[model samples]
Target chain A: MELLGIMLAVLGAALAAGFAGSGSAIGVGIAGEAGAGVMTEDPGKFGLVLLLQALPGTQGIYGLLTAFFAILKVGIIGGEPVSVNVWQGLGVMFACLPIAIAGYYSGIAQGKTSAACIQLISKRPEETGKAVILPAMVETYAVLALLMSIILLNSISF
Target chain B: MTLETGYGYAVSRLRAMELRILGKSLFQRLLESDDFKDAIKTLGETHYAKWLSDDKGTQNFEYAISMELQEAYDEVDRFTPDKELSQLCRLPYDIHNVKVLIKGQILKQKGSKKRTDLLTKLGNVPIDDLILAVESEDYRLLPFGLHRVVPESLMLWEQTHDILSVETLLDSHLFLTMRQLVQKVGYKGVEAWVHAKIDSENVRNILRLRRTGMDAGRAIEFLHDGGWISKEKVLSLLSEPVEGWNRILGFADVSRVFEGVPETGNVDDLVSDIEKALDNYITDVLRPYRYSTFAPENILTYLWSKEIESKNVRIILVGIANGVDKESLRRLLRNVQ
Candidate 1:
């Protein structure tokens, strides 16, 4: 039973890193395709397009941070393993759900937003600052999800 | 949502390409060019520079523009996710090739080369394949939906032996085919654009038939379907005088074109003016898509704008070669920018 508790906590960390990283990969890929297309016509706009293509990557970093905090709370990295009750283990897993689900979806949404912004910049190069701001707006949800997961993980008395 | 993403890359590239298109200021410069050589020099600075340099003289200007148009079509075809959607823009060119080939065949037996050089090399259908299909009467070589029109047009020609009848049959088929393609693509904007084009063509046909003294019943035969204007409206307009056109069209720009012109003046010039007015109206209708980001309408608008630019260039160069005054040539050009 105690083994099951430790396994569940590890699973929570894995889900956070795995799901969010996958989402970022997809989001970055979508934006990269659009950026490459624009670059094909005018290579001079590379700096602007590259910046737009990187906007969806923040979610992955947030997810990784959450996973690291969860692993550290459980003492799974280097210290002696902390024996957690099933309730505490389940609590940690539940805490990860916010970032896992939100990061996965928001990454895709931000990717689509960034791709559109790249298209806008392609047409009006002078509007690159405005284009960057549009996709960054989608980052707000991912940040909120990260905050929820961090607060929940810290409050749990594992 | 998934479908819009499918076109993301293509639309992005098109947005970049749109920047290179000639603008109003460029047209102004071209209009003010001193003479034929000066006009060619003006074109030399635009995207036409490479094509113009290769030709050396303005004699091959039409051929160069045609090549550029083909390249543009090819670029769109290469990028679009749906091949049929891209082919939608090429339908007019395919229909045009069909007309030329059929006419050439009919005129061949009479030993005339009237339309030999009129065939454009810029369609989804290859010129050689279209020629062969016309010769063999096997339309499988043509695009998917266009096969039946060729045989039916030939049959209509056989029955009436009237060139105008054959042309009317082919034109009606072309518009119907365009409507079907737009429906298949499922874009409301493109459908509206197609309907507007049909309405404009219908109005022009009505005016031409009325001016030529053709009976209203006969004029109805050439009227195309799928326009916003009903056939009944066109039928009523056919019986009315040319001065009443402005009242029926209801578009201020179009009405303004017909307001001051005398009814008894030169019919050719009047007809040309009306055609220019319709072209300007269509250009105005397409202008909104200039800012469109992801819709296929942007691609359609760009293609139409490129064709208008090509036509305007041809008009200026041909006018200069013929020593037609700039003011008279300016009257015929559409406000593309």
Candidate 2:
């Protein structure tokens, strides 16, 4: 029974991190690609786009951290015996959900901002600060997800 | 309270105000005007005309815009009742007031220029009084009586007299205020957006300072105290030749458009470009969202959209008045996203 619980925990962590991080990776790539398009047209907004692309990357980090903690709980770190009930497994799964969902949508939004930032740069390169700001505005949700997940995990007993 | 009730009211109001934003035709028409007065006349035909025609028309326009912003903000407050949102809306007014006072003082030092252009009575300390006040007070790192500068900003400002330093202090304060507000509200979304804007603005300011033959030290002094670009990088950037636009451009891929500016040109255009860029950013980008069942997104969006319209009108009014060529005037009109 304990071994089964351990397996569930490990799998859950891997799945959570893998799926959510992948979404973030894809999202950041999309935003970066849009930024690249803008750069090609005007080349001056590189810094602003970099910041925008980076905002989406935070989602991936949140996923990875959650998965790492799950793995530790399952004793993946020291090879100690691990135990988890179904409730714990469910907790892990739900905790990872926010990043996966928010990351996917934020990536698309960030991509659109990257395109706009490019247009902005082409016309008024001096205001790249505002361009960097637009996409960061979307990533707040992912950060909130990471924070909430951490709190949730802390509340649960293994 | 239900999330629907909390979010519904503000979002609906924002959407309605959003509809009133200047469409492309107005931008195009104003762009076609020969000068600022012509542009102002055209603008007078819009909803903004009554305010523009007041005895102190310019001040009236500024106040009317502030009132419009306040109305949009009130809608947000009605829905969410967030104190931070109130503070956010009021911040620009606070800063504008300070800037006006400071500029007025600076000019007074050089002998008074007309104080009419500055927005006073918006709780902007009277220019003469502000000068007397700053002169009497001990200049702390950030200086006393600064409504916003926290300890860090005070430190930075105390260290440098460069305008960039003052800017850095303000930027830092803005970020600090924003971050704390986000944490307090448990709303990370708005915080991220605010930080990105600060970073972008920082990079732009650095380039502007550098282009104007200002040193990194001066830039640091003027650098808005908070941003992603560390002071060290700015120092190195200042050492580069004016022709080294590519080096600055390399810092962020989004900033590549800055490289397109003519190698030989007035720095004023760069300042205008930065202003226009910020305006487009607030209006065109950022999807609105609900957080903690409050409508921060709607409030900020409405506030920013209104600001862009007012700025566009101002551009038109000034252009038409100057009798500038229609083609040139059009090109000068900032794209308000």
Candidate 3:
């Protein structure tokens, strides 16, 4: 029963990495499908389309960073686990929720935007700058959530 | 809600293909061409060169443009995962073939030579297969319930031999299937377009009945099943004069289509103008969907654009061949945009 706190923390970390990574996978996949279609017609746009397809992949990185921080706080990476109280453990778990939830949803939203941008480039390759900017707009919320999770994780004391 | 944004790959591919569709400038160039051969030469420079490069000569421009339209249909069918949307677009061609085949068989039986050249190859069903099915009177191999429509259409034509009746039945079958597919697709844009189309057909029917001195009962009885304006509303418009139709229909913006309609303008020349106007109205109904990201309606819009492009090219080529004036030819082009 005393190990429940760490268990919850681990579950929180898993959720942060798992759902966010899943979101990125879906987002990147959608963008890739669109990219392939564009490239099928004009293979010259491969470099630009590849960049658009990579836009949705950032959420997975943010989620992994958040998970790594949580693991570091628990000292799990050092093979010496911290003696965290139930409250601190709950605090850590809750802190991870921001990135977990935000990354999961924002990543998919960014992917749709990226796909739209890919289509834009297909039509007007000169507008690649605008295409990149549109999907980047969806990244702001994910960055905020990552920052929030980090600040909250720092405040929790063992 | 999930169905709203699923067509990412198909829509993107279609956007790329749309770049190949002849735009306004190319249409202008074709119009400026000195003659039919010059128009064909100009087309040879575009992606349409695939067929023209073979040196089929200028006389086969109809065959070349028709092939382009067929490619658009086949490509949409191949790219889209949504079978119903593709079927909705392809069904008209199938029904057209069925109508021709049924009439051909009937005419051949009565010692008249059937015009095989009129059979369209753009339908989902192969022309030969559809021909065999219709000739044998066994439709088990047909799709989209064409089996039912085939025998029924043939029976109507055989009993009455009224070409109009056979064609109307085939069209109703086409529109009714379109209505059902629209419901199944559950996309609001498609529903809006189909309703507008049905409404336009209904409005034209009642107006034509009143114009041709035919009984209003025929239109009311044969009115299409699905439309935004009610059948009762269309019935009410039957008694109203041509000028009052715009107000009674509740869509005042469409008053322009009826502008030149005289109280008794029954000439076939003017009929095409009103038909073009109403068709433009329907195309305008779907114009908003062109901006959609991943909806199937976007692909449908591209298909319409392609069809319009093909029609305009055909108009220009045929007009140039016959020495028609530019302004007069321009009047015949569909204002789909």
Candidate 4:
């Protein structure tokens, strides 16, 4: 039963990395397509396009950090496994949910915004200052999710 | 991608290209230029400068303008996948080329000089392929909408012994193909455009028939089917005079177009006004999609605006060259701004 708990906790870590990383990939791909199109017309706008393209990628890093924290708290690395029972392992798994689900959806939504910003800067490069802010609005949710996941994972006593 | 196609890449590229489009001020500048040479001089400073290399004063300005339009079509084709709305818009150009090729061949057989200069490479079908297809009497070599049209127009000319018959066949076929394409794109704006355009053309044809004293029964032969107005509804207008057209068509709110039709001596001028009203209606229908992301409507509207821009430039340059007053020329311009 205890082994099952440990496995479930690790499964939560896997979901955090897998689902959010996949969402980031899709978002980045969408932005990249729009970026390549802009660069085709004005190659000088590459810096602006690249910056927008990278905005969706941060969610993947956030997901990876959540996974790392979960495994570390359970002592899946560096030391012997913590003596977490079935309920403690279950609690740890639920703690990872904030980033796991939010990062996935937010990543995709930010990508679409970033692609639109890339288009915005392509037409009027002078507006890059504001264009950067449009996609960053979507990042607010992702930042909140990361913060919540980290706190929950650390606070849950085993 | 067929139904939910994303034009993100194409729209981004198009937005940059839109920045280069000549604005109304530039058109007005060309309109007020002192002479043909002066207008050409002002045009030389714009994005059209590359196309102006062959500018032998005013002689080849038309060629430069046509080439610029052709390049716009080429860019849209390159950026969008599938046989998109850009290619559909070129259907008229392709039909125009076919009409010339077939007519040129027939005239050549009759001992007339072959006028190759009349042909434009602005259509989807390659000029060389069109020429080879017409010369070999093989319709299969042409594209979907055009393949069957080549031989059908020839047979039409042979049967009626009237070049008008061939023209009518080609025009109706062009609309038919355009309808098919607009349906395939499954866009509401384009569908509205095709309906309004065909209905507008039908209205014009009915007016011309009434003027010519042609029988009303024969007018049906010239009308196309994809319009929003049913054939019976449009045909019902023949019994009523021109002034009564608004009363009959008012049910569909189509009377709005006919409201501008002058009652007196300039029916021809009123025809242009009706067309202008319909164009404005279409422009309004498409304007909302202008800033939409990843939509084919965005591309379609952009292409239409580019076509409108080219038309205005042509009218201004031609008017300046012909010494028409600026006010009269301004009246002729289609309002999309």
Candidate 5:
């Protein structure tokens, strides 16, 4: 039963990292395609397009951080194994749910936003700052999810 | 093939290219220029500058324009993964070249001067292949249904000895092909535009037949199928008197075109006026796509707009060279702005 509790906790960490990472990969790939297209026509706007392309990558980092924290608290990395009850293990997995769901969706949404911004900047290079702000706004929800997961993980008695 | 999300990059690239398209003001500048040379000089200052050099005269401007159009089509072809989607735009040119080649071959048999110079090099089928197909009478090299249509058109011509019949046959085939392409693309806006275009062409054919004192029954034979309006409806509409046409087709802008024509009006003038009205109507139909962002409609609309721009430029250049009046040229040009 204690082994089951540790396995569930590990599963929670895996879901948080796996879901968010895949979402970021898809988002960044979409943005990169748009960036490459823009660069083909106007090579001078590379810096601005690159900035937009990198916007969706934040969710992956947030997801990884959450997974790292969960693994550390569960003592899967470096520390001695902590015996956890089934309910406590389930609690840790539940804590990751916010970031796992939010990060996955937000990453994809931010990618579409970034792609649109890249298109805008291609037409009007002077508006790069304004374009950056639009996609960055989508990142707020992702950050909030990360914050919620971190607070939940921290508050839980291991 | 399903249109994938891969269009993101191509659509963005098209959006950027849209900015470089010549506006009404630029065309106005070309029209207002004092003479042919002045107009040429003005055009040289535009995006057309690369194609124009000091030695290239107004006589070669048509060739230059054709080359530019071919380049634009090639660029669009390179951008899209679906070759058939891009080929849809070039189908008309292919049909046109085939018509010219076949006609030229027939004319050559009579020992006339071959007018191959008039054939455009802007189609999907190479000029050499078109020539070979026409000369050999085996059209396996031609794409779409033209391989069958070419020989069948020739055989029909031999029986009827009517060039107009042959022309009508080829036109119907062309529109049929276009309709199939639009259906395949599945873009509602483009499909609608193509349907409207076919209906307009039918209207024009009917009106032309009426002008020439041809019967409604004979006019129906020339009408192309696959338009928004049914053949039965077209036949019923054609049976009405000329003045009554306005009442039947009043919803279309084309109805207004037939309103003011005098009984003794010149055929050439009437045809030109009708052509202008149809051109303007088609342009209006496609105008909504100007705001469309990522769909195939944007690409289709851009290509249409570019073709119209090319036509307007040609009209201005040719009008200037021939000393055509500014007001008349303006009346003839389609508004792309």
Candidate 6:
């Protein structure tokens, strides 16, 4: 039972990381597609758009780190078999919540910013700085989500 | 707002929108294009062509870009509900328009043939009315929100003797207003960007002053009051040679752009690079709130993007018409996005 509990926790953490990463992957993929379209029209602004698209990708790393911490430091795997309890399940669920939510939204928002950045770069490859101002606005929340997930993981003793 | 509801819809919508931007390799192709006509043809075959009419000509590319930008801003604004944020989006253009109007006023007063035709497309303010207003109206002539600050800007400008000093003062005033707006709205990301812009502009102004051999006092007077440029730093750099000044300016990251230009040459490209740098910063660093309505940053980003796209197409078209070679035109390309 204890072994099953440990395995469950490890699985939960992996699940969290996988889902969050998927969200980021989808968001970045969309931005990449849009960026390709813009580049087809005006290739000169590629670097700027590429950087904007990268902003949404931060969440995937955050999710991975959270999961890694849970499994490694917290001994979610390769430990004494402890029966998986409701509290442990809730901990795993909530631990993944911030990143999953942040990743899902930030990915989409970053994509929009990337598209806008691509359009701006296409027109004014020189004024790419001005184009970046708004996308960075969206990046803040993603960062906050990552921070929250990290902090929550750190607090969990499981 | 709780996690379950607050920004749910907005985030989904924004995420959907983000998936639509362009990529890198295409930029190389556009840059490598032979001329503006070729660039337009290439773009016409892309997704952006949807925004353009089937009859959209290279001559009207910038206008089409502007319409697209306005539409993007509108969509963002519709998604967000912050009025102050919307107003902030117009601040940069407002300041740009003000500068254009002031320059026009001065030119018309001196009976110069060039009456600020560069900004005829903006149509935000009239040259004639601006002239009349500046000459006859008090600070009260300014919009209600800006009336109080007009006196401060006027005083700063009055104390400056040279053109550089006047320009710096005006910029300081505008920078202050932008900073205030960014702060009031609690948009720290945009705030950082605005500060960076002000810092870049101030550093550029200092470089111009050094090249002109202006006295230390005069140079200090010319410095924009509240940018990242420290007074002591500028004073120290004033005593150094061009390369030394470049090193200090390079520390600011904006100086690397002026590397090729002669110290005495026009700083036209510097400003252009600064604009590009700010745009890049905005696009990469900031992300709009998921459920929040579009703010000032969104609108400003949209507007700046359109303006640059217009300028790029114009340059490309003009180069094609003038029979400029692809290699030469490449050097002229703004190396931005």
The local lDDT score (0 to 100) that residue B236 gets in candidate 6 is 72
> Tens digit of lDDT per residue, candidate 3, span A1-158?
33777777787788889888987888898888888878877888899999999988998999999999988888778767788767777888899999998998888888888988999999999999999999999999999999999999999877
Model 5 docking grade: acceptable
Expressed as tens digits, the lDDT of each residue in A1-158 for candidate 2 is 66566666666666657766766676566556555544544355567667766766776677788878777765778667557777676676666666656655655555455444544554456777886777677777767777777776677776
lDDT of 5 by residue, A1-158 (tens): 88888788888899899888877887897788778777877788888988999999999999999999888988989798888878878888988888898888888888878888888887788898899999999999999999999999888886
User: Where does candidate 1 clash, by residue pair?
Assistant: none
lDDT of 4 by residue, B1-337 (tens): 1212267788778777888788878888887899888999899888788888664524788777887787888888887864558877787888889889878978987999877788888888888898888888877868856788888888887788788678888888988888988878888877877787788778877877777777768777777788889877888777788788988998764677777654556866666666667676666667777767676776777777777878888888889888989887777777644
Report per-candidate DockQ.
Answer: 0.53, 0.02, 0.61, 0.61, 0.47, 0.04
Question: Listing candidates in order, what is each one's chain A TM-score?
Answer: 0.97, 0.82, 0.96, 0.96, 0.97, 0.81
Clashes of each: 0, 56, 0, 0, 0, 63
The reply for model 2, stretches above 4 Å from the true place, is A1-158, B1-5, B34-38, B58-80, B102-117, B120-175, B234-236, B239-271, B278-295
Better of 4 and 6 by lDDT: 4
Q: Evaluate all candidate structures by whole-model CA lDDT and list the values in order.
A: 0.80, 0.57, 0.81, 0.80, 0.80, 0.57
Candidate 3 CAPRI level:
medium
Q: Which lDDT tens digits does candidate 6 get at residues B160-240?
A: 534554556555666677677777766655665566566665565666676688888767766655555566676677777
Task: List where candidate 3 sits over 4 angstroms from the true fold.
Answer: A79-81, B1-5, B206-211, B235-239, B251-270
Expressed as tens digits, the lDDT of each residue in B133-240 for candidate 1 is 877877875674668888888787778789898888888887888888887888877887788788888888888888788987788988999888777777678888
C-alpha TM-score for every candidate = 0.88, 0.52, 0.92, 0.91, 0.89, 0.52
Comparing 3 with 6 on TM-score, the higher-scoring candidate is 3
Summarize candidate 6's per-residue lDDT along A72-122 as a digit string, tens digits.
644545666344455665576576677777776776766556655655565
Model 1 chain B worst lDDT run, 10 consecutive residues? B252-261
Per-residue lDDT of B111 in model 3:
98
Model 3 lDDT tens row, B1-337? 1423468888888888889988778888888999888888899888788878665634587778878888888878877877777677777788888878877888898999997788888887899898788778789988877888888887887698787778888888888989989888888888887887787787778767767776667767657778887788788877776667767764643555676443445456466677777778877877887777787788778877777788888889889999999976876778646
Pairs with steric clashes in candidate 3: none
Please give, for residues B1-337, the per-residue lDDT of candidate 2 as tens digits: 1212333324433443455568779888777766555665666776666566776655445565555555545555554545565556455555555555555555666687836356643332344454454555433423223633533343454465455555555646555666666666654555655654665666566667666788555566555534445556545656676456457646643244445444436667655655455445444444445222124555665565665666666666555565656665555555543
TM-score sort, best first? 3, 4, 5, 1, 2, 6
